[model samples]
Target: MQAHFDAQQRQRSKLTELGLGLSIDIVAALATSAVVAPFVAIIDRSIISNASGRMPLMAGLQDGFRTLATRPAVLARQPSVVAVFSVYAITYITANASETIALSANADPLLPKFLASSTVNIAACVYKDKLLTHWCSLGPARPFPMASYGLFGLRDSLTVAASFSLPPLLSTMLQSNTSMSKTSCDSISQLALPCMVQFISTPIHLLGLDIYNNPSATAVRRAQVVRRDFIPSTLARMGRILPAFGFGGLVNNKTRTTLKRWIL
Candidate 1:
């Protein structure tokens, strides 16, 4: 009778977890969208150009605000919500401020984008990945090298959200009938909002890129640019991200084992 009762409880737990995870995502997105709409709405190129300078900082500010608004999802993982949010909020705003300032100054557009990738990566890997990893979950033990950070921001920016989103998904697939380790489950649950937002924002990011860099370009031209660029670029990014995230389960297992052995 005890065994039978336990089985019923396990079944209910799975259902509850799945339901709660979905709810968290919906709430986080709804909250974040309101925060994002305002910044992205106004605050285009400052008329003074170089006088105002580095205007893309607002994009970074947008990124920071968006990340902060999504804090509800990360509540379980972050040790101190205020500290983590403040760090990432500052990092993102600072980096993007530089990008926008450079753009307004008519500096080469590519340079700011390239340089900002490194810092953005640190924000994602450290703030997003490291901070959120529980006391003994399978997050990487040390900082990835500078080059790796570059690759992370430059190439995998969108997919980090995807990557972070997948482990629990994999966990769910593997043992949907049973409860998962709390640490593992919570981490994945937290990622749901970020993953959905990243995938959904693919087009928006691309559109912003077209308009911001080529200010003189007409709306039709920007639309044409978006059409011409979106497919090939997005596919290329997903192509890189899919394989990496797809292998996430194996990577998690190995890392967890390594950490366990070290602790012993």
Candidate 2:
């Protein structure tokens, strides 16, 4: 009889443990879904609207506001809610926005441009010293230290590419008049008034990324070196890039109009 009672207690404990774990998992999944759903909805709506030549901005605004309102409450109660929202916001504002702006403006696509420029610049910088040493060690003196000069030239090439690509992309994404898809716009409108709430809340997402991914000392040191030594030269080579990016709205308008005409 005692053995039977002990067995029963053991079974009960096991069941309780299993239930507890399952409960936690369920809550986690629910939280994740809640955060991701908004972002996914926004992206899907934006893409459909853009592809169909409809406006999606209102929808974005609506969604943004709704998210802002609910976010604080959800985060206050559950910390994980904060993380999920942060990821969604970053993905939407940074990656998705860049894509949208690029497509709308008819500028070089953001992904390809950023990838190509970053690759070239990183490669040239990494190899600069090595290449110079190889050339200089060959003899008393080479004709003009072509390798060292070539590194500067490669860096210049990267700057030119970045400048050409960054302006229109940023402009189109940030423009106020750009529209969202009908579905997304509807979703936004349904959220209620005071859409600015979302905009105010959006910065939280940016701050999260900066806090989470901030560089270590090594990274800061390297960036500092790059900025000090390489930035000026690159800027001179690609002067047009900064102007275009700085006057984002104007560039966006020009790029979008040009693309629209070309496509039509």
Candidate 3:
């Protein structure tokens, strides 16, 4: 029995290991989605409410701005929770679908993700943006500039899409898969590696968001731009991302290990 167990362990190949690794990433992504998005939403609503009241338009716009702000983000002043959640959800689906297509075609996932995120973001913006209400009951009617949404979605969705994207672009050089070992992939220490990558890259992600918000006549650039608070602003974002990534990793690792242990 001891020899058989050892033999079975050795039989696991790197390709199999990669598959397992990808599965963990998916679970972690979903877990982060479920936890972080809601957690940030609550905090976001509170912050936006304190400043602009419970108005959805103001909040969504603020949320959208923050979704694409630079590190030491400028969007903190106009914070909106709904916009953040909307972006997060849309990017999550886009990333998943694009990744599948990339794998099927044996191409780098980044290109597909970039394209899909850039496009679908527009759709998500139109539907998810609560600010533009055609119904007279909400407020004064206004023309929706689909251009701004596309630009905002491009930056926001791209950064978000990059978060889960495994292509290891020049931008994601900071991300390291060194944490996951074939033998200990499910360990807490291993799980923490991906979260650490996410933590390190958080600022980079925000900075990418900041780019499209400026330097153009697009609606995104037209919105009120605030000064980034540096340390405090970054800490606020870290608080949102770190907990979600860490908790998601922990939950998935534990659940998977428990089930496997039981079965074996």
Candidate 4:
């Protein structure tokens, strides 16, 4: 009888911990997304606008802020803004839940964290890419090619690695040799890795957009389009990625850690 009572208590305790952890994730995601989403949306709008040749980059940026300042309601209503918020919110929920579970089980968290976030990131990013590209283009929207999904999935996998996996490893390496403070090491790793990864992922993203916009364009023409927009699009993506993954990831991590200490 005592053994069965103890087992029930253990199960209850586990359930309570999970509930509290999920609550922490919800709070952290809400707080972080509130700040990060608008910035991410603004940059996303600019990048898609430039890629679609709908407007110059600078003009797209100005228009983003101007809309925020003058017509905040409309900015809130934008599909880009809604998508960005959803990604940030869902990412935190999954990442925090996975990390909490791994820690409780005394397992390495890096792989589980990467897997948890990458799955959602790939799906959400593919949808967002196609939606934003179509919305930004002056041309009528068309069905997305199958290749576009694969390209976005690849790009987002890299992003998930940079955001979730590389930072802790890089921070540890930086601390071991550089004598940097842990906070400084973390900041540098979190900021630099995700931004640098944009170099590789941005071209993949642009090529995907080209495929969507010009399905019949030859390989030579698609390559030309990528080359033409490569520099500006890469720079813009680096900017967007820093806010979306770098800064946003930091904010979500800190918030969840703080709340876990307080609540869990």
Error of 2 at 2 (Å): 2.4
Show where candidate 4 strays beyond 4 Å.
Answer: 1-7
Top-lDDT structure, candidate number:
4
lDDT of 1 by residue, 1-264 (tens): 999999999888766644543343333323332332232212111111211223333353454346546763543233434333343334334333444455445686344643563455446444443232222123234432343334334334554434443444655664565577755554554434344444444455444443334546787886776575455444433332332233322333344335435532
Q: How many clashes would you count in candidate 4?
A: 0
Q: Which pairs in model 2 have colliding backbones?
A: 55-179, 55-180, 56-179, 56-180, 56-181, 57-179, 57-180, 163-241
Model 3 misplaced regions, further than 4 Å: 1-32, 50-90, 121-151, 165-167, 170-225, 228-234, 241-264
User: Model 1: how far is 62 from its true place, Å?
Assistant: 34
lDDT of 1: 0.41
TM-score top scorer: 4
Please write out the lDDT profile of model 2 over residues 101-210, one tens digit for every residue: 45545675656545544454334423432332222232342233333345434533433343334434433453544565543432232221112222222232222212
**Candidate 3 local distance difference test against the native:** 0.44
Residue 155 displacement (Å), model 3: 4.0
lDDT of each: 0.41, 0.36, 0.44, 0.86
Candidate 2 ranges with C-alpha deviation above 4 Å? 56-264
Summarize candidate 4's per-residue lDDT along 1-264 as a digit string, tens digits: 999999999999998998898788888877887777887888887877887778888899889989988998898888889988888888877887888789777899888988988998788878887888888887799888899889989999998899889999999999999978999999999999999998898889888888887788999998898898888888878888787878987888788888888887
Model 1 clashing residue pairs (backbone): 53-101, 54-100, 54-101, 54-102, 55-100, 55-101, 56-100, 57-96, 57-97
Count of clashes, each model: 9, 8, 1, 0
Clashing pairs for model 3 are: 68-209
